[model samples]
Target: MPEIKRQHGKQLFLITNTKQNCAFYRKNKFQQFSHKIHLLNRQPLENWSFVRTLS
Candidate 1:
């Protein structure tokens, strides 16, 4: 992820499927960017978007 930041000079973005994972990301310094409902395997699921600024 750091490599991408070095190349693009932008923040890193990620989507995680569970709140627990989101909390983990938060603990690691990633901020919540947004939330969305996603369809997976014919089921609807909630996902969290997180971003870590590398610039």
Candidate 2:
């Protein structure tokens, strides 16, 4: 049951993250996309792993 609950929570997180990403893209368009990617590449390994899961 705990494992199932954890999985559900992860699903919820992904859904919310996706929605936020959509809104961000709409607001920023493609102009900031490259900049964001550059920033992401420069992020530390730990932070990069978390960001990779979103994509």
Best candidate, lDDT: 1
lDDT of 1 at 24: 88
Cα lDDT tens digits, model 1, 10-53, are 77778988888987899988999899997889899998999888
**Model 2 worst lDDT run, 10 consecutive residues:** 46-55
TM-score of every candidate relative to the true structure? 0.69, 0.21
Error of 1 at 15 (Å): 0.4
Candidate 1 pairs with clashing backbones: none
Query: Residue 44, candidate 2: how far off, in angstroms?
Result: 31
Q: Give lDDT per model, in order.
A: 0.86, 0.31
What ranges in model 1 sit over 4 Å off? Answer: 38-43
What local lDDT score does residue 30 receive in model 1, on the 0 to 100 scale? 94
